[model samples]
Structure formats: C-alpha cells, structure tokens
Target: MKAAIFFERDGVLNLCETRHGHQVVPLRLEQFKVNPVASVLLHQLKLAGFVLIATTHQPAVARGDLSRNELDLMHMILRRKLPLDDIMLCPHDDASHPCQKPQPGMFLEAAFKWSLDLDRSYIISDKWQDAKAGQVAGCTTVMIRSPWIGDDHHDFVVDDLETAVAKIGLLQNNLYGREVAMA
Candidate 1:
C-alpha cells in the first residue's frame, strides 16, 4: 500500500477570502485563483512517492447556490495548476452526510480506491473539519493555522504551506527513515 497526502481545497490549494472570520469558497470561475506556491510544495510530496489528493466539502452545490459544472470547471483549473492525483468532493449540505468533512468517508473512499495506508498518510488543511476527519481516518493531521482551525484533535499545526510540507518531511523521515521516505 502507498501513502497519500490529502489536501483541503479552498484555502489550502487555492486562494480564499475571509469574511467575518470565515473562509469563503469561490462561487464563480472568475473568483477562483489557484495558489502558485502549492504547485512546488506538492511536487516535493509527489517525488517522495506519496499520492497527492485534494478533498473538499462543496455544500453549496447541495444548497443550490453553486452548479456542478462550475465546480467542475474550478476543479479542472486546479488540476491544470497542481500535481494532484485525484480530487474528492462531497456536495452534501448536511453534516451527517458520510462523505462530508468531519466524517472519514471521503478519506476512506480514497484509501480504498488508491490502496492507501491511512496510518502512514497525512492530511493538510486550514480547517478543523479536515483535522477531525483525518483523526478518524488514522492519517496524521497537519493543520495550517487559521481562524477556522478549532480547538480539536490535530497532529501538527504550522503557519504556512511551506512549513507544513517541511513538517511532513520530518515526520516521513522519522516514520520511514530518510532513504525510504525519499525513495
């Protein structure tokens, strides 16, 4: 089985705006802006033999605020800009939905599809929901410090994506040894 790194969309991979302390998802193609730095950081993980996956909770679709086609276009742009292996998304508005964040359904589904070792994998996000989900999925949770990062279960907290990548590198080295992790 291979290890994977799950990245939260919106704030992590693409740029997002904060409104009243909450990160807002771009509703239109014009609003979507992929972060350039993420491309390089993700390439490092890809070279380390880890599957790069982007997981997101797009509840706006269920609420009828956003269309699937628009979301797909945004995802296409994200794929073109980032070295992501797969993008998993839940369009459910209900928190109880199995695939939604704070639930491990998406992670578990990815694990099954990719034959991934969750215990050896990691999750990077700016939201607490991903951390909660990662905890239940058995992946090491690395949260990017933000207003949405609730006081919940998380393995590591970093100030930025570069730092998060570095932290993951250190953890990988400690877990699998330098040569194995690099290979």
Candidate 2:
C-alpha cells in the first residue's frame, strides 16, 4: 500500500475569506482564488511519492448557498493548478452523514479506493474536525494554526502549509528510518 496526504480544501489549498471568525466558502468561480504558494509546496509532496487527496466539507451546497456546477468548475481549476490525485467532498448539511468531517468516512473511502496505508499517511487541515477524522482514520494529523483549529488530538501543529509539509517530511523520514530530503 502507498502513503497519502489528505488536505482540507477551503483554507489549505485556496484563499478563504474570514467573516466573524468563520470561513466563507467561495460561492462563485470569480470569488475562488487559489493560493500562489500552494503549487510549490504541493509539488514537493507529490515528488516525494505521496498521493495527494483533497477532502472538504462544503455544507453550503446542501443548503443551496452554492451550486454543484460552480463547485465542479472550481475543482476543475484546482486540479489543473495542483498535483492532486483525488478530491473528496461531503456536500451534506447533516452532521451524522458518513462523509462529514469529524467522521472517518471520507478518509476511509479514500483509503479503500486508493489502496492507501493509513498508518503511513498524513492529514493537513486548519479545522479540529478534520484532525479528529484523521486521528480516527489512523493517519498522522497536522493542524495548520488557525482560529478554527480547535483543541483536539493531533500529531503536529504548524504555522502554515510550508511548515506543515516540512513536518510531514521529517515524520516520513523517521517512519522509513532514513533522511530523504524533500525537494
């Protein structure tokens, strides 16, 4: 089985607007802006042989705030810009839904479909719920320091995606008992 890195879509990959301490997902293609730094950072992970998958909880779609077609167009642009292997989404407003964050459903499904070694994998996100799911899913969890990152069980906490990726590199090296430089 191969290792994978799961990323939370909203703040990690793209720029998200904060309104009253809450992230506002882009409802239109014009509002969606991909982060410039993400490309180089993600390229390093991809070249290091980790399958990159994006996991997101877009409840706005379920609430009729965002359309599926618009979301699809955003993801298409995201995929074209980033080296992501797959993008998993939970467009449900129901919290108990299997694929919702704070649940391991999305991670488990990705594991099954991608033949991933969960133990060797890692998850990066700015939310506590994603960390919780990553822990339950048996992957090392790295939380990017943010207001939304609640106090929860996680393997590491870093300031930004670049630092998070470096931390993953260190952990991956330790797991394999070698110092493989992350380019």
Candidate 3:
C-alpha cells in the first residue's frame, strides 16, 4: 500500500483570525497566510516520498462569508506556494450538511481520488473534528495544538509542523527498516 499525507489548511498550515466576532477562514488570496514551518515540513515530506494532500472544511462558503470563486483564488495561492499534490474541501456547513468534519466523506473522497492506502497514510489537523474524520477513515491522525479545541481523539499530538515532520520521519524510518529486514 502506498502512503500519503493529508493536512488541514486554516489553523494547521496557516493562521486563522476572527473578525466582527466571527471566525474568518482566510478567503482572499491576500489574506492567506502560511505557517512559518509549513514550507520546511512540506519539503521534508516530499523528500520522504509521501504524497501531499490538503483536506479542509470550509464552512465559510456555505455561510455566505465567501464565494466559491474567492475560495478558488485562495487555494490557487496555496498551490503556488506549497508542495501540495491535491486539495479537497467540504464547502458545506454542519447544520445543512453532514459531510463536513467528523464525517469521513472528505477523507474517503481523497483516498479514492488519490488511490491512497488509508492504513499507510497520515492526516494532520488542529481541530478535533478533522482528526476524528481521519481516524474514522482509517488514517493515522495527528493533532496540532489549538485553543479552540479543549480535548479530542487523535492518534498523536505535536507542537508544530516541524515537530510533526520529525515524528513522521521517525515513523517512516522504523517502518521502512522493518520492511527491508523482512525482505
């Protein structure tokens, strides 16, 4: 089974902000901000031969906070700067749609599109629901620290992107070495 790595966009890969007492998910291209360690981690993951994918729940579009075109522009910026192989977004709100986070639909879609082996894949997110979705999809889930979530279920936890990258490297080394020894 081939391995892949999936990332959540808003708080994990970029800074999320609140405006007018509402949480904003950076819909504009100019508002898009990448985390300081994102590029470094992405480069390392690419070197490790992991297929990089982004899985996000963008409820802003469903809530009329942002249009689909604007969201596309924002993703274009991300694609230009990151070593992303694909981006999958759930553009529906929780109330109107159940296919959002905590639902395995998005991850399932990604696995199908990319022919990913969920058992050998990793999903990184700063939200509990996102982690839950990944977990339900049979992927190793890592939670990045976030104030929004008090507690949640995840396979692993890491301080930041760099630390997450290091953990992945260690896991890959151990797994690959075991495979080689067996062979």
Best by lDDT: 1
Q: What TM-score would you give candidate 2 relative to the actual structure? A: 0.95
Alpha-carbon lDDT, every model: 0.93, 0.93, 0.81
Off by over 4 Å in 3: 18-23, 95-98
Query: Estimated TM-score per prediction?
Result: 0.95, 0.95, 0.89
Pairing residues by index, what is the TM-score of model 1? 0.95
| lDDT, candidate 3, 64-172, per-residue tens | 9888998898788778788999998888877445568788887787778878899999988877777778778898887777664337678888987777778888888
User: Against the hidden true structure, what lDDT does model 3 obtain?
Assistant: 0.81
lDDT measured at residue 129 in model 2 versus the true structure, 0 to 100: 95
* Root-mean-square deviation per candidate: 2.5, 3.1, 2.2
Better of 1 and 3 by lDDT: 1
Full-model lDDT, candidate 2 = 0.93
Error at 13, model 1, angstroms: 0.2
Q: What's model 1's overall lDDT?
A: 0.93
